[model samples]
Structure formats: C-alpha cells, structure tokens
Target: MTETIHPTTESANRYLRDNFAPVREELTATDLTVTGRLPDHLDGRYLRIGPNPLDDPGDQHHWFLGEGMVHGVRIRDGHAEWYRNRWVRSAAVADSLGEPHRGTPGERDFAANTNVLEHHGRTLALVEAGAPPYELTHDLDTVGPCDFGGTLPSIPGRPGYAAHPHRDPGTGELHALSYNWTAGNRVAYSVLGNDGRIRRSVDVEVHGSPMMHDFALTERHVVILDLPVTFDIATATEDVPRLVRPLVRGLLNRVIGRNPLPEPVIARIARGGDAVSLPYRWNPDYPARIGIMPRDGDSASVRWFEIAPCYVFHTLNAYDDGDTVVVDVIRHPTMFATVLNGPNEGPAVLTRFTLDLRTGQARETGIDQRSQEFPRHDERLTGRRHRYGWAVGFEDGAPGDTLLRHDLDTGSTESRRLGAGLEASEFCFVPNPDGTAEDDGVLMGYVHDRAEGRSQLRVLDAATLDDVATVHLPGRVPAGFHGNWAPEGADLADV
Candidate 1:
C-alpha cells in the first residue's frame, strides 16, 4: 500500500536560499582539496547541471524554472586537477551576462537546466518539453544549441531534445522520447546511431500531453508512459489575473473536481488565473496508460495497458524476463501539488512494475517503501536483467538524505549517510576498469553541507556502501538534477 507522507516543506522560495541558491561567481580553483585517497582508474570530469537563475525570480520562481549552470570537477591521474563553473548561455542568459549567443534560428531558446551529457564528441546541456540541447565545450563553456548537425527534426521552429535519453550499451545507440506541448497528443521516438545522427524516428500517439521525464527501454520494446498529469489550457493563457485565483479555483473545482481541463474543453468553458502557470497537474480524471511498443513497430503496433494514476520522474532500468517486461522506476503519488514553486508532491518511493505481455495485465510492487528518488542501475546492463540499483533516500525526521543500494536478486538493501546536516543527490555508479563482479565499482555524487555552507564529491564503494573518497569542493553545489561519471577518452563513445 502507498503511504501518505506530507514532508515538512521549507519556505516557498527555499530554492533561492542556502545551497539551492545560484552561485554568483564563476571561479576556477586548481589542485582542489581531497579528504581521502582518490582512485587511480578514474580520469575525467564529474559533470552536473541544474537551474541557476541569473537573477532571482523571487516569489514567482519555480524550482524547475531558471537558467542552467554546469559544474565540473576534473580528475586526472587520481588527482583533483581543477574545478570550474559556467553558465549555459541561452539567449536570455547570454543577454543578461552580456555574452554572445551562438545558436542561430533557435526555435525555443530556453534554459537547458535539467541534465548535461556528451554525445558524438560534443557536450550538451539538455532540458525537456520542447527545447534543443545547448552544446558545451571541453572546459564547460556553452557552444550554443545543437540539432544533431541540423539532422534533428523540428517540431516547428526548433528540434526538440529530451533530458534523459537512454544509450544502448550493446549497440551504442541513443534512444529518446521527446514531447512538445503543441504536438497534439503525440510523442516522438528518436534514435541516434553511432554517429549521433537520427537513425530512426517514430511518432507514438498518447492520450494526453503527459509529463514524461523518463522512459524504459527493453531488449524487445520501448516502454512509454501516458500518465494523468497533462497540460492545461488555463496555464497557456496569461490574461488571467492573480486577484481572481480564489474565484477561478472555486469554479474549476465545482465543475471538474480539481482535474485540469484540456485546451479544447477549457476554451469553451473557463479561463485560468496566475498561480505560477504550472501547466501540468495531478489529473485524476484522465486514465493512466503505458504503451509497450515493439522496437521495430509503429504507433499502431503499440499495446496500451491501463495502470494506476501516478507520476514517475526517473526510471532505474528495464529488461525482458521470459514473457514479461520488468521496469523499475521512482514512483510519486502526485506532482505540482501543494505548491507550484517546486515538486512538493507526496513521498516518492521506488517501485517495480511487471507487465505481462501474454495476458495484458500490469502489476506493481514496492521495493523500498521509504521515500527515495533518482534510481540508477548499471548502464552496462541497460537493456538486460540487472542485480543491483542505487537511489537517494529521504527518510522522515532525518536532516540529510541517504544513499541506498538495492540488490534485487537477494532482496537486501544497504545505505550510506553523509552526516547529520549533509544532503545527497543522485549517485552515479562507475564500474571498475578491471572487475569480475557487477558491483565492483564506486558510486559518486554531490553532497551539500547545510551547516558548513559547502559541498563535496563523495565516492563510495558500490559493493559495501562505504566511503571510499571525498573531494572537498571550493563552494556549494546545490542539490540538483542528474549527472554522470565521464572518464577521459571514453566520452566520445561513452553512452
């Protein structure tokens, strides 16, 4: 059973305060402090990106909205060589900073503030919901928006790129599911080959314009989420004043019981008022469905299975198991609820869903009932059965987050906590250069210390969940979104 958890939320603009606040200085520090012995096998930069607004949006700021900033910690020959921070120069950011914008004819020139990745020898900062990725240089400087060398198809004025794209470990192909708000209820599947060009593209129709942060890729199928949360017409129109919000909410609840109205339905009935214009809401009226489409099939070949209404921000991994496809993901009860400034939804738990292709039935099982999010597995086992996965845990009454490692085969979990007032972000597993077992690696991520007003890169033994190393950074890196372990010379083909 799903438990009801209402976390003790901070101030409405908590993101603008403390470690969540944007770092103003773009400084470079060399030969950084290392608390423990750095591993010899690691030789690359630990890169992560998040929304760091150039100017405070104050009360109107949403946690997920803002300009993007990329932070990098270069590790060379087991030494912390350098650490630097740079802002991904979107048109808005470039103009604010008095820098030159690079990308020409940018359709939707917005911040790529979710994730940073390297593709086809080019580093790109990415965002979801209809924005092209901003390419970056080796030193983490923005190189403008990239459209796969203009081969990326445009929804209108610009090509859409998703934040989370799964790279097939076996085939070296990158698969992504991108949705545009104006696409009329259809999501596109884009597959990039070894050369980072779109090798295959397909449009899959969905019920509503659901917020798809991540998807699952099995050996035989591409799993797509068509959930209840979708776009609202009222959010699109900016004419609704804030003074009439109570009146509008009362009228909307009376008619639809809090479920958001589609564009067509609201166009005929009502208008929306300003409440940060969140656009997507936890819509209970819309039925939740998951589409299991064959790898070589089109939209018509998809098998839609109705499931419970919930939201998933990140998926751990998925693979085929006999006649069923098993997908592990971070499940949230609802999103954009309670507060529009950030994701103050109920506790997010790690859940496993098993879809029986033979019977067309879907069943879900809770793995770790404790509050956890941002689950990641071994990329080497991307489309194959895996034994281990790691996630960041948010236990009630605890001051900081815990890093958890789950062994699916043994039904055992191990956890690592930084300290009393230090928070952890998504931990990425880096496999050992020469290892026999799957768990022979180190898990690395950023840890923000509230008391000290600083952050550090923590490395833990993946097998034992013990601290292996810690690089004390010069400044605090906010508890941000996803990141990866980019070892040197491996980024070109390091999907």
Candidate 2:
C-alpha cells in the first residue's frame, strides 16, 4: 500500500500539547511508584510458578495464585458455596526478579498477568511479570522456542499479551495469537500440542498501536489488524519536564486519537518481519477495532472487517456458524475525551456482522444500535450447535438503565430496569448441567451500590430473567472489569 502524509494542523498540535501533556506526566509518576521488590507477606490461598523462575525474563512460564480460595458455584438446588482447593500451598514465590504485586489490587509494579483457557481443555496463564515467579510443577513443561517455529521474538521487559485460545478445525491445532508491544508492533502466534506444548511461534508485524486485541482464528490461519502509529512509553512517564512533555504528549494523543494504519499495512505486517513507513495522518481520536475471521484451507484467505470513524477499545466476542461469523462489537464512543474529562455521556453499541467464510464478504445485519456496555456471553451458553444466547448488561436511558436480554435471532431486545438507586455491571449465565432442557439455567451479575460502597452478586433465572438469589461479597469486589463463571464441577482453582 502507498503511504500518505496528511498535513498536521496548528490547532490540533496546540490541542495536543495543552491537553495531553499532563496525562503523560502522571503516567511517569505512576511508573516511578513501582518498587522493584515483592512484599514480605502475601496473604493468598495458593501460589504456583513456572518451571524455571530464574530463566531469562523473556521465556514463557505459568503461575497460580489464590488457588485454595478458588471454588466453582453450582446453580442446582439453589445451594451456592465455595469448594476449597484439594491441594494447598502456604506461600510460594516465583523466580521473578522484581517485587511481586497482585494485579487484583491494581499495583503498577509489574505488568498484568492474563490467563487464557485453551479450547483443548488446557489452561495457560501468561503472567506479564517483569521477572519470572517461582517454578512450579515440573510436569508442566516449558514450550521451547523451536516449538514456536521462530515466529515470535522475545523482547526484554515487555511481553506480548494473549487472548482466549481458538481452535482450528482443519489443522486440529490450537492457535494462540498475541501482540508484542515491546517489539515494534508485531503479532505472533503459537501452535499448541494436544499435550499442551508450544509447537510453533511466528512473528507477524501489525502496524498502528502496539497493543492488539484478540485475533480471529480458524483451522488454517490467524487474522490480525495492523494499526498504524507508534506507542512511546517514555512519553507516558510523568517525570518528563513540563516544556518538552507537551511535544511528547501531543505525539501520544495524536497517535491514539487517529489510528491511521491502512489495509496494506495489515497485510504487510502479517507477512512477517518487514519495516514499513508509518502513515502520516491526524492524531487518532478513537481506538481502532478490527475484526478477523480465519478461512478454512487458504492461509491468506482470512476476512477483515473495520469500524471506521468510530474506534473500539473494548472486547470483541464472536459466534460462528458453518458458513458465517457473527461478531459483537462493543465500543467506548467517548474514550478519547473521557481520558481527560473522566466518564462522559457517550453511547455504546452491539453490532452484529455476518461474514461469508468462503467469499470474505462482510454484510452488516442492520443490528447496529445503542446497547449496554461490555456485553459478554456465558461460556456454558456457547457451543457448536447452539447459536442463540442471552447478553446481560445495563442499558442506556434516562432516570436509570435496565438489564437487557438481547435476542440474537429476532434482533428484538427486552430490558428490566434496576429502579433508580441500583446499577449493574456485566452478567454471566450458568447453565444447570443436571436440570431439564426446558430450564434455561441461572443468570448472575453484580449490582453496584456506589453510595453504600457495596456490590452484590445477583442471580436470576435465565429463562424467566427473574431474580433467583443474591450473594453478597465481603469488602466489595471493587467494580471489576470482566469476569467468568466457573460451574459446580469445574475447577475454579484452575483459573
């Protein structure tokens, strides 16, 4: 693709310097708060580390925390309780070089550790720890670099982030896609063995922002959207001087606000290590959300869908049928301005797009409209044959928003408001394994009472959408971002 440079406006430059500089200064201050030491005491149920903690920081490993306190809830008989972990470890440390801070507490000492549960029933959690934690069971093998087939390059401090794994039906291989922000905006993939070993790693360059969301995977290939622009962390640090900071801040804001990467950049980046010129364009005011659908036999046959003008910074969920892929796009419409002014009155949407697998043709289902924030599907609700499910979240309206049940087939929506006082976050539906087919199962969500500084887990019947029970958590769950449900027999400890 040909590179084009758009002339930068003086007003835009002045806006960037004036409004964005302080944000970078504050981030620098936060970075300084990171102490390179773990606390003397960590009060947690269990802790697991990788094979070699002292190994090169770039090597991949696994760890577990709060293992004993983890328990799965069964909706059957209305008995909800925690089941303790069978194995217990008092206090275990990883071989990490820096002081460990629990991500649950929002400590900035280390990078966030994300757990991706693979489709082949293997749970692989990648801890973005600056230093490796203690080594755990030797039985859990280390995925050698050769297994990755030299597709991924390991950066020193910053490791790539991973999403939930997707399986390819044709190759019978588990494909895990990750974005390495530390490595010049590259996308990498690792093929997993049935025994849970890494089979291959290939580094694919994707332009735009260094961070990437979950990529779509099919039996033959992975699809990634290359966003243009470079993310400079030094500018994000607060310690930068006030005068020079404006320039840095302006650059950061412009890049984030205007995601300028084009389609050619995406294709070129996916083709492996190739240095492409950055596109010259106005600062990206919105976060770019790209949707991918992997094709069957053809490696280059992946389908790409882009949401223009509006950028998406939230999660992307998909439900696939034999011939088509249904994507759920949740966007934070006012995220850019919100960064400076806090939360504003902006709308979010749940867009459904149908992509033909064979032709790579994308047709919007005309289901685009304002909807709830962070609409997530229950794991138990998703299956190969099952196409219909419920998405629960607070809707947008005057007075107060209500919890909505969105029907995928009919494109009709139903909502129940939480009165004026109460507010709800995301919801999960847990199906009853032992219950009859007629019973749609249970719906669970958090009802946040900000005034009272309390949150309650509200459970309802999936079929009727009526309250079943409310489980009050101690010391407030602190308005979590996203969560998953673990059924009765499932090992919450595994998470």
Counting clashing residue pairs in each candidate, in order, gives 0, 33
lDDT measured at residue 78 in model 2 versus the true structure, 0 to 100: 35
* Model 2, runs deviating above 4 Å: 1-78, 82-154, 157-159, 163-175, 191-196, 216-234, 237-307, 313-316, 319-324, 337-345, 356-361, 366-368, 378-386, 392-401, 435-439, 488-495
Q: On residues 243-295, what C-alpha lDDT tens digit does candidate 2 reach at each position?
A: 65566445545543234333332233233222121122222642343445343
* lDDT scores of the candidates, listed in order: 0.77, 0.38
| lDDT measured at residue 417 in model 2 versus the true structure, 0 to 100 | 67
TM, every model: 0.89, 0.57
Kindly list the per-residue Cα lDDT of model 1 for residues 226-334, writing each as its tens digit.
8877765455444556675456545544433223334443432223332345567677888887889998999999988888888888889999999899999888888
* Top-TM-score candidate index: 1
Task: Provide the lDDT at 262 for model 2.
Answer: 38
TM-score of 1: 0.89
Leading candidate by lDDT: 1
